[model samples]
Target: MQRIALLFLILGLNCIAAGAAEHSTACGSMQLAYYELGTLYYRHADGSYTGIDKDVVEEVAKRSGCKFDTVLESRVRIWTQLKNNTLDMSVSGIPTPEREKFAEFIPYFSTRNYILLHRDMPVHGLSMAGFLNDANLKVAVIKSFKHGPKFDEWLEKLWAQKRVYEASDIDSLLRLFLARRVDAIIALPTVWQPLLKKEEINKQVHLFDWAPQDSIVHGLIVSKERVSKARRDLLRKAIYSMADDGTLEQIFTRHMGSKLAQELRYDGPRF
Candidate 1:
């Protein structure tokens, strides 16, 4: 009785609000995968996962009385599996119309996507367009990432102009930029800055005047085909409860500080 009460309190709901599923039921048996966001869910030497997103997911599970067999996989595989109904949930996803067809979202936080300029460029006040138009300079992006509709259109023009360098993931993109192989990179500091080792490089990089997507969000995306509507609603309510109780704020602020949290506009379920 005491343990159930504690869970209910943490979840910000009475268990009676939504009849609890058994520990071995469909939603409880679902598989969860964490995308390879370095700080978000990197494997420790001991093979355990820990990060802001992981913490949020753990709390949601406790509140909703759900359990998952967690795995770490590539973002591409995670999405493919979710579409094919082979995977149950992913904690790191940016919602899009295409994704909406396959997954139901419970957005927990937002992120900023900005262009990083190599400080060696003698020009000040250079914008993303100016950098892209310069034939000698190359811009880096993760292949097939939708930085937002506008950015995607601009990237198409880049393809015709032969000014784009494609990387398979953020790690490779960062390497190409840091090695002086690319003049600029489009990325999120919230996700990339923590992976950087050299404080000097961070100082050396400057933000381009144009932000491609200033307010792209990150969230839990559960498979619409695999999880029932009831389960999805239960999870969504649990996530919103965390935000309402300021648990989401604490988790993000601990990793990103108050300023970035405010700047990125950490929010829940705008959809």
Candidate 2:
């Protein structure tokens, strides 16, 4: 009878341990990817991710009790991995309709686009019209960037004239501009600021006073298959909570600087 009691006690302890392990693992592990950019996201010397997207997502995960891992990769690879189920989610400033088929966006941040040009480049009064009309001009744009169908049509027209160069990444395009290989590049101010600062090209590049075709709305994109509705809702709620509590603003301010925050007019659902 004592031997039988010991067996039952051992079984009970095993069950308790199993239950505790399951509880600890309830949130599961997820992988999120972001571009290796200065303002958006980047890997630290310690192999950790940091930037606006990282800060916001980490805060949401902390509040929601969701365990997550981050992958710092190229934007192209991130999208490819996300499609293949290697990445659970990503934060992208521009999400195209083609990408929407595989992922759902949790709307959060938005900003207007801008053009970056060499400060001493003589062309003034920069505009879409001016760029298209100048045969001597060369413009560099990134691959997979969603500038809408209208812009694509305009680019096709420009391409016929050998005016626009499609670059693999922003860094390459920026280098082209710095080397005087291209006349200008179109990108959001947020993206330009960090890279310009990094290359000490701030004094060399000038932001033209041209109006953007559209304002970009940034969001957290999750794989539809990987995240359940309950977890998705929980994460969204946590983001909203962070916004309400000013945590989002604090994070943005820490990385982006207060002056940039004000310039961007970032008065929205912050987190």
Candidate 3:
């Protein structure tokens, strides 16, 4: 496994010129749409993009001998564009059957744990069902996102009862929690901690380790229609190589922290 995951040469024009190749990844100089999902992807005032996702893409672009121009959009719009074959790729996408119908996921390199944060700590042993049972309580979650298998099931139950409040993104989720619109909101410490400080909401709420373990995984979600099978395969191999070389780990740990980087190690396949 270690040998297979080792850093491979980033493909360059010289490498291609050295030997004649047939199919191109179509990744050469393409436009990409990104979602403003915290540290994963950030947009700048000049309309340029930068962050962990950017780093990964740049690395891949360097290897693939491709250049990617990026634009920011809402998650829903990102999916819509992908379905319409207007977008190229995205980062930190948690795979689900519905998404796979339109896009293909590369080898996931990061693991994320979802926990419930509340205005105050609830009773010990409180479960997701406990929250669902109380009609008065509302849980805030990102729209069109799958929070692992267990929470996905629980969220379906909550949705059926109209007990869940869906938001467009994490910023909106934080707003919903701040306004006392939802009793609890699902969050990732790496994503929300900085927001809590910047927005000055740390003292206003408390976090709960509701997730049993850290298993949720994510990766670069590329559109199948826009990216060929060869390109996607190329990206998958590159991502796995990044993990093996600790480049992926360093990039994530630098922005998110070492503890989270360790917790969210590249654990092979996501089931």
Q: Which pairs, if any, clash in model 2?
A: none
lDDT (Cα, tens digit) per residue for candidate 3, span 58-175: 7877566556887778889887888888888877787788889998887546554465456464654156667766777778898887776677777788888888888988878888
Q: Tell me model 2's lDDT, rounded to 2 decimals.
A: 0.73
Q: TM-score per candidate, in order?
A: 0.83, 0.79, 0.82
Error of 3 at 225 (Å): 2.0
Mark the 10 consecutive residues where model 2 has the least summed lDDT.
Answer: 262-271
> 1-271 in candidate 1: lDDT tens per residue?
9999888796766554454445325456668998766556665689776777788888888888778788888888888899888999998588888999999888887765677777778573266566666778878998757676556676788889888999988889988988989887887656565744468667778765365445677779999889999888778878888888888788777766776656544554344
lDDT per model vs. reference: 0.75, 0.73, 0.72
Model 3 stretches astray by more than 4 angstroms: 1-27, 43-49, 121-126
Clash statistics: count for each candidate: 0, 0, 0
Task: List model 2 lDDT by residue over 1-271, tens digit each.
Answer: 9999999999999999997776556667788776776677866789876788888887877777778787567778878877887678888545677787788777655666667776766654266677788788888889877654445566788889988888888778877888888888877656776766755777777786455545566678888878887777767778777766878767767777876654443345433
Candidate with top TM-score is 1
Candidate 3's TM-score reads: 0.82
